[model samples]
Target: MDSLEQTMADAQARLEAAVADRHAAMHSPVVGTPDGDMRVMVLRAVGQGLAGLRFHTDARSPKVATVALHGRASVLAYDPVARVQLRLSGPARIERDGPVADAAWDAAAPFSRRCYLAEHGPGAPLPAPGSALPADLLARRPSLAETEAGRAAFAVLLVEPETLDWLRLDAQGGQRARFVRLGDVWSGGWVAP
Candidate 1:
């Protein structure tokens, strides 16, 4: 492969490492709130392929509202141990109560599904701390079919990245590059680190 392709592949590998890092977060850098503030979200790597990365969130959450208002956003994945960081910019599409969301919800972990089972919406004012799920449901893992009840509150944010930029800082030196999508083409080049 050419140098540019190799750089992009290396970047993707670093991003995958970050995503697979259980100790640290698989995070997105910013989501523009309607008021134009930035929100950082620790997202689960629900899916990553030709469709780009997908993250699951609550339909009533602020992030969903934010994405609805401003589809443009960026995701930053960093692996401290690997000394690699990847920044991806894209347009986010939020899907709820649809086929896309259905599949995502169904694929979610049982404990994760419990988040949607809360009686109140996310960030709701609770009389006390915690998600405030029913006492019974809290003790056990809900079945996949049981999770269906929470489907209405589940949402999937699919981000189609137009640009994927990366930086690798090491003891020896630092390397930076970016792959930008212009129309139907995807071209990449190095940058000063």
Candidate 2:
């Protein structure tokens, strides 16, 4: 592969690793606010799709509504160890029900699925401060069959990228590149960091 191709591949690998690291807080969706600001939230991504990243969220989530209204979104992931920052911008879609959503729900861990089983939507006010689950389910993880109840609230968020800015902050020097799809080929080159 050529230099730009190599750079993009290397960056993609680093981004995938950073995103797969559950301990890292690097994988969050940043949605545009009405005032043109950005709101970032901790979200668990299912994986990367052909065009960009895919993640899971509650159908009742404010983020879901935000994506619906704006259609555009961004995801920023930084790996301190790799000294790499991946900034992905794109149009996002919320899949509430379909083969893809079903597969995602089925693949989720019971603990992760527990969030969907809650009695109230995210950000709902509680009469008293607590775990936010149905009172009866507060003590234990939901059973597999019980997970079915959460499916209705589960959704898949797909981000189709228009651009990916890859920045490497190495001690030797800093290099940045922006990747964009043009026809069947990838196009980008080193730019100012």
- Give the best candidate by TM-score: 2
- Model 1 stretches astray by more than 4 angstroms: 16-50
What lDDT would candidate 2 get against the real structure? 0.73
Q: Could you tell me which residue pairs clash in candidate 2?
A: none
Candidate 1 has an lDDT of 0.71
Writing each residue's lDDT as its tens digit, candidate 1 over 107-130 gives: 778888898888888777998787
The positional error of residue 140 in candidate 2, measured at the CA in angstroms, is 1.1
TM-score (C-alpha) between model 1 and the true structure: 0.82
For each of the candidates, the C-alpha root-mean-square deviation to the true structure, in angstroms, is: 3.1, 2.9
lDDT of 2 at 10: 71
TM-scores, in order shown? 0.82, 0.84
True-vs-predicted CA distance for residue 8, candidate 1, Å: 1.0
